[model samples]
Target: MDKSYLDNLKFPASFFEDEVREGFLVTSMMKRYWASQLKVLSFVVQICDKYNLKWYAEYGTLLGTVRHGGYIPWDDDFDICMMRDDWNRFFEVAKKELPESFQVLTLSNNEEYEELIGRVVNCNVIDFGPEHMEKYYGCPYTVGIDLFPLDGIYPDEDKEKDRVARTRKVLKALTLAELADVNNHELYLLLKEIEKENKVVLPLNDKLKNKLRLLAERLYSECDVTECGNVALMPFYIPNNDHIFPRKLYEDIVELPFENVYLNVNARYDELLDLEYGDFLRVNKSGGVHEYPVYSGQESILAEHIGRNPYRYTLDANELLRSVQRYIMRMTRTVDKDTLPNAESMAGGSCADSGAVIKKKAVFLPCKAKWWKTMEPLWKKYMDDPGYEVHVLSIFYYDSDYNGNIGERHDERALFPEYVQVEDCEKFDFETIHPEVIVTQVPYDGFSTFMTVHEFFYSGNLQHFTDELIYIPYFEADAPIEKGDKAWTALSVMVEQEAVVNADKVIVSSDAMRSFYVDKMIELCGDETRMYWEQKVESFEKSAETEDDSGRINNEDDKSDMNAWNQFLGKYAGRKTIIYYITIAFLLRDTGKSIGKIRRALDTFSDSGDKVCAIIVPQEQILNDLANIDEALWKQFTDLVEKIKTTDNCIYDEKGFSLGYMDKWSGYYGDASPLVRKCVQAGIPVMIENIDI
Candidate 1:
């Protein structure tokens, strides 16, 4: 070796002299114990012979024979090496050939245990399960035979060197493999997968490792495994020449005396020994020179890498160390809802907060029911004014069997028993029951500012009505059902429809809920600010534009002369029309039906020769199922392509027979501007589905 090589190999007092010493000592003792385990070796040898495995004693086991005639007195382990091809063959044949007392411990013994084949282990005495050495030290321990496969080497010396230099790259990502059969440990399987050339990649951040492991598995499924090249095993030294004896006397086996046993050495023993210890057969004694435990032969080299990167090991570490830290800098940080910029960043649109205009009128305050006591404070803050004409839309008890018809059976007290009005909030348009602002309690904290900015920045029209739409995220905790499915469903519809794009901007009632939303939203979107506002603006603009009649208005003054909203009210004010159509439920719940019936329905209604109109389902899952249906059925459904509109209708409170009452109208609940515009442009006729009241 060059002088520079020696210098580079110099052991550090901190890492080598101390940390590595104990490991070496434990490993050496283990190897010695293993060598003395003649019964175990005899069994292994028999298995190898019976299976015609071309195996060789490896590491310290080989060293003991060459240097000390047998196991080094202090060594405690044994190892064997085999060429990849031979190892794979042995694994296949040994299953039925080996004695039942001793099974083939290779990974290929079972698909679930494949990782074990690539790992190096201290084979345990099968008679005694696992052995704990930490009783002698302060850590946990287990025993198993050490095995290393000799993989084919890349011919390029540089590439071979690069492969060796890369250490423990997949160490931190080991996981428990779900196996069908228990042939070996799960850790081994994880390691085996990583060792495959195609599986290696730069590790993700520590926090993402677990999730990435699943992702990696999925990704690996798409990779071709045959691309891996076979690399040579033990490339640096000649196999037949023991350097101490010179090439003239190279042999496969030679006799030597050990502490209490005699052993045979391979011809290249001296060459292999010299590479690991420098002075082969010179150290008549077997012990670690450093402060750490000694490892027999070149096994220490393998053990060092294994200790640091267990995923590369044939097995997984029983225990691991992890650290976590979290800190919150401040409390009760409130962002001004109106301050957010528009969404015009790169996307040429402003955030939803822009141009939000809410027109409010006198609102009548209804008497607070027992259930609404929790909402009194907010009502006072935003609605308890004398001028506010709070219109009391009929309030019915949850038990009230409200029929579809708006018959004159409304109880005044039940609807509006209390008349206390909020000084600021007002009501407008009792005929349409105009709801300029929506108020609800959100269940999280730290989103007041975010909620505000997200609410209106998209319209370039932030007006006071934006404030009227208050949200209290955290109210008293209620079951999802008790929370009023209708309310949350309505909320979801609004969001999905772009009715209120930045629903989070509405202040949540409970601090705890606010905090939850803040964390969850941050976790989901990463960039909470941009994502929250961007989505809101997009939805809001779409809704606003859909609600407008710009094409119909020839002049700005003419359009301004009459409120577009008023004109819309005048046109469709009380017109009730029956809407008979096939519902999406046909696909989802129509499981009992046959293909012929489905096709008939599709041919006539879904895809008539004249026009194709099909009932669209709200659930995408059902939609996908429809897409995957049999081709014949699909053809029938698609026959009337032109007449069919994929648009869907949104219905709420369908329990009461109120199909289309004057006081209650059902229209598209998504972005009004976009949805309306779509209908008008397509001449699709956006109408309330109802029987004329």
Candidate 2:
């Protein structure tokens, strides 16, 4: 490899002269750093040229290219963006094409960075102490060209809102995981809302953060840029849709001169600059995103570097050129071999990049957060090991007709522990993932609950997608099942289960339970397969009093959300709270009798001498959704709601109140619905009474 391109680079002595670009001083230090960054940009341009990839000058870089031919006088690193597909192509080649010291950084490879962007960098480690390194990716300065991925934009109003909302939620999740600025009011509120949506990424560690970064990547890639009319800026850290723009603006590319070489900029730069910033040709001396030369502090580190490495970085250009000529002839350089340069790239090119390097051994299904405890011991054993991976694909379930979801009634992802890499069943790709081992807690398949996993997720079907299937009964493993004939009856259904019979391994909570399973399976199999059944049925030997058991399921917001929950629950205190939840069943069929039931419940509570409090909670979104509906029966229902609010010993709860507050109620009087199951999961007593109207 030729090293001459890097050998002859120099910062001219004229840069030290009192010359200014945008009324800002062009210091020798800034010029030298730009020269170093331009070299890195040249290397990236080489790779992009080799692959025929596309990237456009963006943000301040775009403003600089039009107004200043290269970098703005006040800007630090260059800003660029590529369509996500192009970025993915770049990643494949970047790994091998980059020079030895050069590296492309993304959340995938760099834990220090939380943004969904990339940086093609060289050997430079800014030593800003541990605290600074932890917060600002080693100082607030841009180390290299910031490469943002532009993803596809959804045009349909609903789809666009959904796409933006999901990205924003994930952004909030990333913020909570980083906790970079817990004091930001907007961030604090968004994190509070995002965690309420899903807590699967809770108790965050380096691993779960990577999972979230990839999850957002998946969401961003949901739309194809080629088919879409617009492209969206990939990061949704801020709450706005203004980053989206028409795709036609970027269709034509013009490689304009940046420094020594050409870099990409949209051909319609005039219109874009006008649209983004009105009167873009004018000099904006104060709007640079970064502090000109230094990072946060007033210290000039680059100037210090110039004086520190006087051998080659001298302000005397003639002296540098003379030394270079002599050093080339001597065939040896005096610079230290290990000194950290300012991200200086040489050639064509974290916690150790956990995103790309690691792969999980299996995907586990816990159904809901509570069932996770059933397989947790084994899960931790595999998770703690370096080579194994466990993805908690929290699969949702519905009845045969798809009427009611069995578990995960509400957003159970919020109750999940942090550090667990959890995702929804909708994103699960059995064919693509092709997990080596599938440890499932549900065994009854399609028979027992009229409620089974989708045909694709059935354990019998899952057996085909995985090399090994392990069935650990949710009931026996977590807690004991029903006593006597009910136990035997449930076992009869469970023992003959396709999940149990076909599984490579069947785990039970106790040896006694394992013995019963082995004996029962052997009896069902004509006693000829006693040895097979015994070997298949193993036990975790977990004691009846499960030590260190998880308490996440019952108490969704034990402490993290105590403030939010207590504030909601303060009104109905000092009494036995009973939730009278109204379901959406009335939307389909309203007979007026259900409204009568609601009135009776509230009246009975009022007459109980204020000892009991009844909360009328509605699952229907009709409160805000009702408009231009003049139905007489519905009018009576609305009147009842108003009465409940003002009546003694009663409260009308809004739809968005935390389920945690509802779970704290002593009893539930509601329809046999998802909310009822949620109450059951919380171990609160329940009576299924319908509110029809």
Candidate 3:
């Protein structure tokens, strides 16, 4: 490496030449960035040479040294790697010997930095602008040289594998640990994945980062460098030969001209480049990783130093670094809600703080009363708790032909628990109420389904009215469907509904369903966003539970529905009961056979007059649009369903969905619909009958 001009590294006039190469103009700002980076590199070389430490150009730096005389024209950063031992020694020397203008930064020195490599940076910053625009700058932005450590491979194959794997995980442990904060999702799931990957438990606490750091230090440095013939960079390395390169590459070093001065290169730079990139001779500038003139995000301080060509003032290096540290601390510090930027107006673009309430509200937003079973338990939990004021906002909705033809207006607030407060959707101002939590059953944000909530009460827009928007699927997924199934297009839409996506939490019926949604989401957005979906979806074992298949409420009660169920039980004390399950699928798919089956099943069971009482359980959705659902088929079941009232032994339930077909159910009868799936799930040994249409 060139050291003759160490005290006065000359900036070449040719180095500042701007030329359009590869179809674009190379800006003067980019040339200045290269000059600043070379200056930082010279400082690092001086320190390493003084201490007898070794580092060779790596990554793009090596690529540039072998292919281009300097940085690959468009590349913005510089990289070099040293054997772990030399890396350690260089750090020790560079800290004490480097001048004030250059700052050696790593995880140890900078608390906010989470990068895997160490950096030697100029204390001064860099600014880049659109050729036409100006005045904006980035804070903490500066030209820097990245330093990576190459650790020796253990002689034992198993041992090397273990070391490489652990090192990779420890590096992951460091990065993942940094991601952990107050939000209990994303980073948290990855910690569990770490334990699964390496059997290492990284707990979330104050010292997790320190613990992982020490572990990484021990794992990488404990191996003897001289004993091992092979070495690899751990973060990029794995338990394979593909990433490991020859140890002799760094044993002998050669100098290569980089810009105006010669920089150190591995003696086997040819072979090293070939191993790193299959065709090292190929000139592909498409692989450049960072944005040109990458801003350090330290603009306020940079504005002062950027125009330093005339030397307007002398900067106090210590105080300047202190200012940077202060800015970093301010950026990284855990901020409280009141102190957060624009925090006062965080609530729906309003500046006035929503005042404290005596009792925070937990609103139950149900468009239809039948959908209440899924939300009733939560309402009860909040209702019984003194801390929350529970209200059932019986939201208004409309059933449509989806061509703008509104079929029926459903404002069913009649069956809610009388003991709980029922709010008038029109009069109970959501803005004034400012409920702490809002639980909605319908998640279809109009476009996904035929049902549409009153525009003012759409779940998608409700996010602005409350701090927490919770969505519980009003219906149940009897079984998961394959990705290519005909129903999946609509089902996928339901999964990604604005109500489901915008809500703070989505409570699903089962883990199987949750996994189904997650897998579907992966298909939709690729695997990168799986962690987000995992955290967003929740499986409910008990709380916010929905009713089971037999239209039976397991433990939840919608006062009037429960009363209707209990009243039906009173009349049929000594008789066998048949729950004739009816889903809209039956009416739509079975050429009026569902209507025929109900009659046949009822009449067949009614033959035993005093011994049996048949109950026709039509699915809840059939109640609203049954008449208009199929002008063709509605004529068949119209008179049959009404037989429940005229016949003494036959029973009809207003909210049959609110009841569970448990031990008392003698027969289960339904078409090949989702209710059959729910029947098998209930495990009630009721006789199954599928009548031939």
Give Cα distance to truth, residue 200, candidate 3, Å.
10
Question: Taking the tens digit of each residue's C-alpha lDDT, what string does model 1 give over 1-693?
Answer: 111121122211111101111111212123323432443444545666676665566667776654344455345555666655566665566546544444345333333343333332233231122232211111112233555555443446675444443222232233332322223345445445555644544333332344333433233222122223432233222132121122221223333333333333343343445555674433332243332222222333444645631111121112100000000111112243235544466557544447754335433222123324444444554454544434333232111101111222223343322343233112233235434444433221111111211222221122233333333322233112222222221122122211122232334334433333343333333553444433222111112332242223134534453344234334333333212232222332233342334334334442233222223222222233345533454454444232233222211121222222212222332111122333343444553221111
Q: What tens-digit string does per-residue lDDT give for candidate 2 at 1-693?
A: 111232243333333222234323443334545655766666777788799999898987887766565676656767788888998888778868877657678777677666677888654554434443332222313446778888887668788677668777876667666665445566556645655654444333346566667767777777889979988776642266567777877875655545444556775565567667776655544454444443323234544754532211112334323423433433332244355442224422232343355555688887756667778877876787887777778877543311223542334676677756678767878788888778987665654323456666667577777766788876532221423322333244355566676567888877767877877766656566676667667888654344455545435456646666546657655668788776433432334465677678777888888577777787543453232232565577678778987888877887646454764678988643345545554678877664432
RMSD to native for every prediction? 32.1, 31.9, 29.0
Error of 1 at 225 (Å): 18
lDDT of each: 0.33, 0.61, 0.62
Model 2 residue 590 CA deviation in Å: 58
How high a TM-score does candidate 3 get? 0.39
lDDT of the structure predicted as candidate 1: 0.33
Q: What would the TM-score be for candidate 1 when compared with the true structure?
A: 0.25
Question: If the candidates were sorted by their lDDT against the true structure, best first, what order would they fall in?
Answer: 3, 2, 1
Q: Provide TM-scores for the models.
A: 0.25, 0.38, 0.39
**Which 10-residue span in candidate 1 carries the lowest summed lDDT?**
319-328
Comparison by TM-score, 2 against 3, better one: 3
Q: List, residue by residue over 393-438, the lDDT tens digit for candidate 3.
A: 7888776421334657777776554544677878778898788888
Best by TM-score: 3
RMSD of 1: 32.1
